[model samples]
Each structure stands twice: as C-alpha cells, then as structure tokens.
Target chain A: MSVQDDLETVEWDVSEDAHITVDNEQCITCEDKPCLHLCPAECFDYQEDQEGGIYFAYEPCVECGACMVFCANDPDKGAVSWSKAEGGKGVEFDFG
Target chain B: MTDVAFDVVVVGAGRAGVAAAYKLADEGFEVALVERAKQPGMKNVTGGVLYGSILDDLVPEFPEEAPLERHVVEHNIKLLHGDAEVSIGYRDLELREEPNYTLILGKFDRWFVDRAVEKGVTFLSETTVQDVTQEESRAVVHTDRENGDIACDAVIGADGVNTTVGRKTGIQRTMRNEDMALSVKKVIDVGRKTIDQRFNLDSDEGAAYIYTGFPQGAATIGYFIYTFDEYISVGAVGGLETLRWLGDEGYGETGTPLYSLLEDFMELDNVRPYVQGDAVEEYQGILVPEHSYDTLPDRHDRRVALVGDAAGLVLNKGYTFRGLDYGIKSGLVAAEAVMECAEDGDWDAFGRRYDTSLEDSYVLQDMKQHRHLPKFLKNERMYDAYPGIATETLRRMYSAETDASGLTWRQAYRAFRRSDAGVLDLLKDGYRGLRSL
Candidate 1:
C-alpha cells in the first residue's frame, strides 16, 4: 500500500485510566500552576473551584514525570504524583 | 528453465544489505542483492545525517559526489520548559572542511545501492523474498514477484527492524514496543537566507539541536535543522511507550497531538521566531529500534545471518544517532565472516564466526557499553524536573527590572529549590547521565 493510504487506514486508541493525579485538598493559593507549564502534552487544565481554589484535570498526561519531579519539594501543597497506569492498558499507535 | 545461483544472496537493498553485497562482491564472491521497493531508497527512512567518518571508510572522497545537504557547523542542546528554554551548545569550523560532516542524503539508500551495483554486484529490485528453500547443504530463495528460485551458499538478512527473514529463520521472535522509539519528522522549505540568519549559520553550514525536559516529558525529543539548499529537515523522536501513554490519556495518537505540542512550544513568545513561516514539505514517522544489548538476537543461524536492525543494533545515546553506520559496519563484518567461511569450505561454522567477529568489533562493544543509557533516559526526572528548573533559572538570570534592587544569586538558588529539585537529586541525575556516556 502507499504510505498515505497506510497512514489513513491506521487506528489509534487511548485508555480510560488516568496516570496523573492531584490532591485537591492540600493545594495552596499559589499564583502560578507550575504543572500546567511543565506538562509536555499540556494535559492539565487549571480552573477555579467553588471555594475560589485552583482545580486540575489530569487527563491527557504523557506520564513523562515532569509534574511529580518538579513538585517533590513543595512544602505548603502537594502538587502531583505519577505512576504507570497499568500494563498493556495505555495508548496504541499504528503509525509509530 | 534456467538455473541461476550465487555464492551469497543479500536481502533488502538497504544500507546494511547493499554494504554486505558490495563487500562480498569485492572479495570475488558472486552476490545477488534483492530489494522489494520500487527503488533502493523508495522504502527507506533515515535522519539524513551521514556521519562523515563512517562513509569515508567505505568509499573514499564520498563528499564529492554524495547528495549532501550541508556541513553541520553548529550543535545546540536545549532543556525546554513552557515558554522558557535553557540551552548549551557549540559551533565549530573544523567540521566544514574536505572530510566535512554534512546534513545530506534524501536518497542515500539508492546511492549506496548504485555503488554496490557498480562493483559487479547483481541488483534485483521490485522483488520480495517470500521464504528460503533450504537443502541439507545450501539454500534457495523464493521471491513473491519473481518466476524462479535463486539458490545461494549463504543468505544475509539485512531487511531492517521488521525483518521477515529474521522472523522466518527464528533468529528473532518479536520486537517489543518498548524496544522502539517513535519519531515524527518533516522536511521544511524555508528560504536559505532565512535559515542562515535565524540559526546564525552561513549558507554552507548546518545545525542540529536536541531538547530534553518538560516540554518533551520524560521522553526525549530531538530536533535537527539540517541545512539543505533551501530547506531544513526538522523533527522529534520520543519513546514509543511515552507516545502511547499520551495517546491513552485521550490525546490523539496519529501525530496531531504531537504537532499540537510543537505548536504550543513555538507559540511560546520565545520560540515562535525560529520556525515562523517555514512550509512543511514532507512529514514522516519512523520506528527506531532502541532495544538494549540483552535484546539483540543471535547474529547467525545455519545458512542465515542477520544484520542491521534485524540484529537490533541501534544506539540512541546523547553523543550520536548511529543506526545506519551500525548497519553498514555490521554488513561489512557479516560479509567478511562469510568470506572466511567460504574460504574454509565450512558452512556450519559460519554462524559462530559471524557472532564472534561482531562481539570483537565496535558494533557490539558500543551497544554493550551504553546498554544502561536507555533506562537512564527513561528516568522521569530527565523529562520532568530538570526542564522546568533550568528554564526558570534562565528566566531569573535573564529578566531585567528597572526600579527594584536585583535579586541575589542566593535567591536564584532558592527559586531553583522552590521548583522542587534538590542538589542531591541533581547530583544523582548527573551520575546516571555520566554513566550512560
């Protein structure tokens, strides 16, 4: 098959389980959400909670460990923790 | 029916296969080189850098006739975080001379294949080897698109990472997904003047850059800007597992998400200028075999021998991107082993000789030496903490404020500490990085 045809016919699937997590209760009123800036996939979404606190969405995480590595020393608030989702349960790429 | 046979049959017409055929033919062995592609390079993929030293050994004065893009004059390594970037790089004029390192080879596979053909090696294109018809002594090859079988004394499987010959011969059972790297690249057309001025290069020099840090995740992303006459070959490579992980998290996996990531990077007020207005002429993706030394299959089995990615010889460390050279070198070594076996009239000892020679050569030594690099690169901190901390540190160092007293370097250290990476962790990472080299 032609390269273009082969690429068009390929399919991609994503898993439902989230690999990145954030503890909402411990967060402080930090002005900048560092996780948002460091994420390679830009997976995190920062929004105001009902109590005027920052809420995060951890979907679309590439699991490159940027958040956890950068947030390890935060004394006031725990930013993020990362782990492998599950074996044989993540993304599948036909082109790659 | 006519009976046609050779002393050696080299499959796949790629860098490895062509090199093997050329070397064997040069040593007075009748060689038949088979290729499945419409042309030698039509189905081939490469990063387009022909590490000059490797080619010079194979064919002297190669730079004179080789389709080289430009001699690399600059090398840039960047740690990127959000809109901030921390870069350390070098430029050298020594690489621009006669034995220059050129960013070339859009059609390198074909070029090598032609050289092999010129050296009395038979070229059979548009033909695929379906299977090997083995006898007690010799083997005959069956082609899918050809009418007759071609028998040979030995067969070399240089068919790349997904080698059917290697699979059929049971030399390699399968290649694991983690053992591969997924890369997306594009040949971009920007005016020569634009490329030279933007990258701080003259018309004859090329530049390559690698970025590791948050923007690339724990996964390493390398961008190369090889100067062609009026275009630049730019791209990124990351672990296949990392790409899949991102895809599983609901980001599209067919390169659109990665393209979006690149867009986000370029949109950053700092990075937008370098790639602005460059038209992407071609976009392609390839799988780089990144299996550790433990994953490498046996070099030989009876009449069959594996070379190149089929043998799992790809090195992705920081110093070099070296699969093609490995392919060429291994191909030559395999041919030499076969020549020795031919001289001895001992077909059974061919496999052992090939393996021992490979172990003795730099091909195996390099892989064995850097076997830990893949795991080290896979460390999350390499992608996560370092980029952000470095970029933030650069920002603090570079920014100018008019009214207030400047913050002390101690404050800068505090900012780095505030980023959550400690001195001990940095030292550990440094040791691991050093060990990888």
Candidate 2:
C-alpha cells in the first residue's frame, strides 16, 4: 500500500494551524535536502511547480521530530521550523 | 484560570513524568503532571516491550493490574542476508511472570498516568508547556493556556527526545545526527489464532524478534517484530549519521525515505508471512537517542531535574535497546532526590544527590559500562561484512556441490573471503566484537 494508504490506518486530529512550516526558499539553497529522505511520514516533498522546490504539509505528521533535527543540523541552518501541534491536535496512535 | 502552585511540576506525562509525579504525591508532596497529548501515551511509541521488574517497586500489584498485551516467553536475535537468515533464541517458562512484557505505549501510559492521578497528583491534559523561567524564590513553568503559569518548588523534565525543557534550560544542545536514530513502526491485527500458530506461542506467551542487516547492510538499520495478543508491532530503526552519509545513495538522492525502508522490510520473503495481516492497525514513528551516555548533561540545575529521554538516559546496545526501563528508574530516582533535598531545605544538594543516586543505581551504571557501544556500532563491517560472512559461510558449508564430501570449515571460510570480505576486516571486527560485547 502507498504511504497515504498506510497513514489512513492511524488517527489524526488535524489542526487548522500548521505546527510545522518550511522555508522553501531556504530549502532550495540546502545542498542535501535531507528532510526529503529522512521523514518517516513522508510529510516533506519536492515539488518543482511550487515557488520553492519543496512542498510540506503538517496534516500527516506523526510528530517524530526527524525533519526538525536533520534540517537544523544542515549547513544552511534549517529551512524547517517545528513545534508540537497544540495539545490533542495531531496524530494519536491507537496501538503505538 | 488562576495560576496554580505545586511542590513539583513534572513535564510530559509519559512513563518518566508519571513515575515522578506518582512518587512525589505518595510522599505527601503536591504534584502537577502536564501532558502534551489529549491523553497519556497517544504521542509516544516504543519497540513494544517493557522491562517491568523495575516497575514492581512502585506498583506492587503490577503484571496483574497493568494493561499488558502479552507475556514475553521467547527472545530471538537474527541476522538477515537477501533471502537467508541465521538466528539464535531462547524460551523459558519462568519469564512469563517477570522482567519483560509486550504492551502498547498508548494504552500503558494512559493506565500509568491514571494511577498517578489516583495518588492525588493533579493531572493536566491538552496543555502545552511553552517554556520555563526560574526566579529567586521558585521555578515558574509557563504553558500555552490562559493563566497556565505553574509556580512550583521544583520541575522534573520527563519529556521525550525532542525535549522543550532541555533546550529552554540550555542544559542540552541540539542532538548530533550520529547520536540519534529514526524509528517507524506499524501495528498489525492478524488475530490471536494467527499469532499463536505463526509465532508458536500459547495464549499468554509472546515472542520478540530482532533483525539486523538490511538496506544492503551499509546503513546499520535494525528491524523488530513483537507479538501482542491479537496484534504485532513491526518497524525499523536507521541511524541518522549513516542515513545522511548514504545521502543520494540511501535516503534522498536515491528517493528512499525511512518509512519506505519499513515497507521494503515488510515485503521481504522471509518477513512477509509473519507480518501479513487483515489490516494495518496503526502507523507510528519517533526519534530515539542511541549511544548517548557520554554526551548526557548533569541532568539537573538547583530545583530542576531531568529524567528519561530529556536526560539522555536511553541506551542502544547492539543486540537490544533499553529506554523505557531507564526512563522509569530515573523518574523514581529523581523523585527520591527531590524528597531528600526538600527535607534538608537545601536545593543546591539536588544535583549532587540526583547524580549520585543514579550512579549508585543500575540506570547510570549500565550506561557507563556500555559507553563505547556507539563507536563500536559505527563500524560498517558489523552491518555489511559480518552478515555476509555468516550467511555465505553457512551456504558454502551446507551445499553439496562435490559428489560426496562436504566442505570443510577452512574451505567455507576461504569461499566467504573470496565472495565479500577479507582477513583484515574479519580480524578487526572479531577483536572489536570481543572487546565491545
């Protein structure tokens, strides 16, 4: 099954506010763009038609914090800024 | 909506936070347990096993009262290569009552937090802690809600790997990529009868399987499968350092995200049957601290102490991972340290006592003993050359190529060296294995 299909099995309380935002312009300058690779939820994507070369949606975030850490350690500082979804407003695992 | 005051305010109501809050409340100290999730355990994930002996000291009627999934009676560690596998395992009936059990962290943490609430600890859910500021008279924990500032004598930081307390307090720097790993898991429902027949278990018995050598073995990614009554948790843990190093070849340039690695593992011929189920129950992931003992801070400042991942207490031994137990034990110790210093009316003694108590306890002692494991794990040969050596040697020894005679040990060793690794790689890894293990 696709990742989108896999994500459907878990529960999420989507928030109107984006808990994580990506500075796409900064991401283009990033040489490695590790978030495109490291995120377990595949929340970060590369989209050529976008203003910058990246696409990010916080809706499917499992709140693992990999993107935040990996991006912050990159040479370009970090294009991604992350915080937890307001309490009770993100992924909630029924069987973690 | 008024600002509340308590003797102790514990952050992140997972295993560590609840442990500290429960003990302090039992000791007659007013405690507040702040949680980020709507309920305890919703935001947490582990490899699905809890070493519960340490928990018995705090809750006497444990294994009986806990929300456990299964009693782990079998343990296996296997090395995988392509379609081949080599494993060693042990099963003991005595293990059914103590030491280890399979559980869902979401269910277990909620039950544990409920116990703390019953002990008179003020439980606050759906409240996010913004930051904390310390003043001369007391420590003030700031939260995101109206009048959410909590005044307290002390704070116990039990938040997970991405700790707000660690960063805001300046006690921990950003974790190095080498020191952390990304673990993604999926819980599958295949029914109790399927679990019994597939895993060869009785109604209450469970099995834990650990597999290494995947993603071509260069990345040191490990996979785990644990049997729950009617579900199984399957996942993979890949080191950040190696994943980044692999770069285009491993994570990004090659278009292989960490989650896809779990997919690849699940589809493997050897692993498919065990995990094939009616449906995927839940998908989850978390950042794990690995081989971090040396870099861990003192874990305390005057009235604020840290426990669990916030204190960098997780240990990733090559064959097994131990975090929940350490988190629980440290929470208990942090509570003891708080009570001791409070009785003496000396907050300055908090650090010394917390550190000394951990050193005297098994938590820190075990970490100190395996302090060099991170360095040992970095040797690429452990993931690549070693598994190849074992699988190739076995294949050569068992094949009946020649008419009658079987291959000798020396012949198999020669063929193995010819296929993948060399003498020097073997010697270096063998010696290092002896020293590290």
Which model scores highest in lDDT? 2
Best candidate, DockQ-wise?
2
User: Which regions of candidate 2 are displaced past 4 Å?
Assistant: B247-255, B402-408
Error of 2 at A47 (Å): 1.7
TM-score of chain B of each: 0.89, 0.94
**lDDT by residue for model 2 (A1-96), tens:** 767788888788898999899877787666666776778777877788865567898998999888877886555648888787786788888787
lDDT per residue as tens, model 1, B1-437: 21688998998887788889988887888999987655565445566455566667668857777666678777777766655677778887876763545443336666777888888899987666767655788878777554657888888988776666776677775444466665555566788998889888878788776666635465655554455667766556665445544532232222223444455554557555676654656555555677777776666887888898778788877645778778888888889889888888987677678888989989889888888887777777777677676656556666664222356565467566886678898898899888878
The docking quality of candidate 2, as DockQ, is 0.65
RMSD of each: 12.0, 2.1
